[model samples]
Target: MRDFLPADKARRERVLAVIRERYRAHGFDEIETPVMEEYSRLHAGLGGDNEKLSFSILKRGMNAEAIRAAADDPAALTDLGLRYDLTVPLARFYATNRAQLPTVFRAIQMAPVWRAERPQKGRYRQFMQCDIDIIGDASARAEAELMTASLDVLDALGLEGGSIRVNDRRVLDAMLDVFGFVVEERPGVLITIDKLDKIGPSGVVAELRDRGATTGAVDALAAYLDRPSSAPSFDEAGIRAALPTGIPDEVIAHLVALGETVAAARGADAPLVFDPFLVRGMGYYTGTIFELAHPSVDYSLGGGGRYDGMIGRFLGQDVPAVGFSIGFERIVDLLQDAADTGERSVVLVHDRDVPLSTLLALKTALIAQGVRVRVEQRAKNMKALLERSAADGYASFASVGVDTTAESLELRPLN
Candidate 1:
């Protein structure tokens, strides 16, 4: 839905380059998937709310009219949709190609995804997701490695002042049980809770009540939200004690161990915190989930977690998988905000009397000598044209007069 100008494009490419190098160094191989995927697969209850926002493609060919006749029934008219994210399509790709791929696959996916939703400040209907995933690894080490690589990318981009909020689905399930929330109502409850940061506590309580949550459950949640930690690192013991006493020991152990391991892997001054209420909206996440948030922004930069059963739905057997995605658009916005707009490029200006061949020869020589050069006949007043070209990223200017020879091409730096 947007076109990137030259400076914007350059900034985006710079961030992507950093991501690619970091992913490669971590032993991940790049892969791409079609932007369009079958609508059935996308809406198979995998993508959560993203499924509702998918842009579906209408049926085409000889039966197009027949399909349109049933436009009232959208299912009959559409069979494909623009992919909403990179994860599900990745699941399908791995399911189809697992036999040929290595038993342990480290994959990289950097591409744009489409969603039919209202655009916000940093949220776009079309934006790129840079993901790094490991399939076939069931251990917490996979999660640790993903955290390490993702954090390294943030560091490389000089994106400081952020914290990684970590939590597990099992912990959420245990807490819901303690509050007497039924299994069927947990998803809806989580969805409402995920919006707590956007709409305040009052909004979530209203939505949960509307969804038929018991008054007692809402009261308990309100009491819990009253004491949010002021510091970035959350209190682990405080969080654990909030759950039921008989909750599975493995749940606590897994969270504690992953926290310790990821912190160690992240090295000195690691920024990891435990947030019991960090409920990611995606239904596909089966285990650990984390979100990256900056103190200055109300939104998350990006997040991902273990979708152990997502691939199983396709391959008929589970494949342990974990991933993390950096918010490509948000990062670009930050970089652009801090960018210097000064131009370092050169341009060649000529008049109608100047032969086209002469301008071409001059441009070719400058390019051969390793210069970023642009050539154009005079467009407007010389001063206005030069000023406009400078704003468009041209730093130096050259002019060819009637008596000027190729050997005497003089260059002058534009102020």
Candidate 2:
């Protein structure tokens, strides 16, 4: 949906390099999948709202007969859809190649995904997702490592003073149940709650009421949201005390362990926080969910969580997996606005009679020596040419007349 010019593209690549280096340092190996995948896989009820906005590809050639036969159902006419995220495709990839992969796989994926949603300021219909996932390891350590790696990437990018709001799906479910929400309404309720940052408490209450929630339920939910904490901390005991029904001890312990590990590793100034109301929209997230927030930015950098059940759709058995995705597009956008590219180049001005091959050889040699070079015929006014070159990020100029050999070219700095 966007075309990146040289400077913009360079900034994006710089951010990607930082991400790739950080992920590799954390022992994640990269993998790639096709942009399009089976429509059934994309619509597998795991991606939450993303599934609804997926762009499907219609059946073609011989498959067109099926479309004609099943005209009543749009899905029958569509065989594939562009992948909305990397997680689902990774599930399929692992399921297909599980035998070749290690028992515990730490994988990194960087790829563009498509969605058909209406674009907003930072949200795009097509954007890149940079994901690091740990599969086959169900321990709390996996979640901690993922969270730590994500924070480390942000730190590498100089994005400080940001906080990661952590929560557990089980705790959210239990709390919703206590608030008189039924099983069927939990997803809708959680999805709306996920918009708390954008819509605020009053908007949420109105939306809940419009969605058929009772007056008492709405008021109780609002009152609970008012439970004050000076700072975000995982206070399972306080939460359990406030609600009569307690959350599972295992869930509490896992969360506590993750928080402690991250804090100790990151020292006293660690940015991890516990916000009970942080309900990420992905429905497949079975355990922990988190969102990253920064004071300098209005939107989240990125988020992800434990989708222990997603791979089951492919492998027929649950393969515990947890992942975090950095909003690559958004990160690049921020970096581009603030990037100071220390790039310099030399413009090669050659006589009209200079052989094209000779000029090409000079260009290649300069490129090999780590110099950015551009070649053009000699301009009439040398001062004007040098001025133009300097304005366009070139720091120097080189002359290659008909008598000048590739080995005897003279270079002069503009400034």
Candidate 3:
């Protein structure tokens, strides 16, 4: 088990509380799911490239023996894996429980997800994901609300200065089609182009070339993706002026309107940027994609996209959905750096005059008063008790010995 010292636990809980309060204020209902889930539901196309990182389970009876035998073979059982992301499970949940739920469901979930990746500074084999998603809405207003809520949550968490970058998949798809790339190969192409930030323009070109994209298509894509965010603004007029050789004017108008709506939502305090190259990695995302990043962090703190078709795979009917997830562990690490170090006082008690029940009652009362309390166990004398409390980071102590009265207890502060 991972050991979380008292100080660390306190800090984590503080951050979590802020997140919960902000999400709750926005009308999102909290929901939870089991840590373990059947493998096939999680391993389907839902998880994207991270699907291989899932941790699977074993069953009992003949099935258990079969799983054990398959474990020996190494390649026999791949269906029973742990949930890789919360959105897929939420999609499954809505499909199964839709009849009992409202036409529009807004929910928040905070839980630990297991990933078998090599651990690093901020990356762990196990971590928590705090997510919010809205289902059954096709309007861009739902997308706008999600983005606003995400920014509010981060701001409430004390990330005073940051950016929530936004982009639409349709815009990028139009750009690709303009450059003569076939629609069937666009997903793979977008995946490679999304790596442009990690690998430079030349690297992206090389990858696209390796994937059988024509030189002309690769060159145009590289130029478009590499353009600076401030290269030029495209209003309706500018969009019409730059229309590709054979594309329809109506398509350009729709793309232009989408951009206008996103731009109008920006405020003076929190600015949104549009990057044509921002392609979220999830294969199921059919519309807009977004990511949150801070100037101090080297990677995205969190991200998500619109996956309107995901539910159709399970429910046999279309349910438009959009979601965003915060990397809970990463946020915790960031908040730890920003947290203030204040004195924490825990009252440690010992003695027989105060029966065990009375001591516990006192502890509970102190807790109700918002005071931290820790009853030291195994200390025989005041000196030992004080020393142990000091070592354990407690600043105060209360003792009830055999000679003490129930109404009058001894209290002391340890230096």
Worst 10-residue lDDT window for candidate 2 reads 235-244
lDDT of model 3 at residue 319?
Answer: 92
The lowest-lDDT stretch of 10 consecutive residues in candidate 1 is 227-236
Query: What is the C-alpha lDDT profile of model 1 across 53-162, one tens digit per residue?
Result: 99999877627668758869767778999999999999999999998899989999999999987987667888899999999998778887888788778778888667
Best by lDDT: 2
Cα-based lDDT at residue 360, candidate 3: 74
lDDT of 2 by residue, 314-384 (tens): 99998999999998887777776653456657899988999888888889888988889988788789788
- Per-model TM-score on C-alpha atoms: 0.87, 0.88, 0.81
The alpha-carbon RMSD values of the candidates against the true structure, listed in the order shown, are 3.1, 3.1, 4.4
Per-residue CA lDDT of candidate 3, range 1-415, in tens? 1568765676777778888888888778888877776776777767887777878765444477687778774236654666777888888888888998878888899887878888777777777789999898777666666767777778888886667676667767878888878878888888888888888788989999999986788878677655554422445554444434544556455445545555566553334555657888888888878888888788888888899999998999899998989877888888875543345566646653547776777777777867778876545566776776665557777665644443565566787
Predictions in order: lDDT: 0.82, 0.83, 0.73
Query: Considering lDDT, which of the candidate structures 1 and 3 is the better prediction for this target?
Result: 1
**Model 3 — TM-score against the truth?**
0.81
Backbone clashes in model 2, listed as residue pairs: none
Please report the candidate that would top TM-score against the real structure. 2
Pairs of colliding residues, candidate 3: 39-81
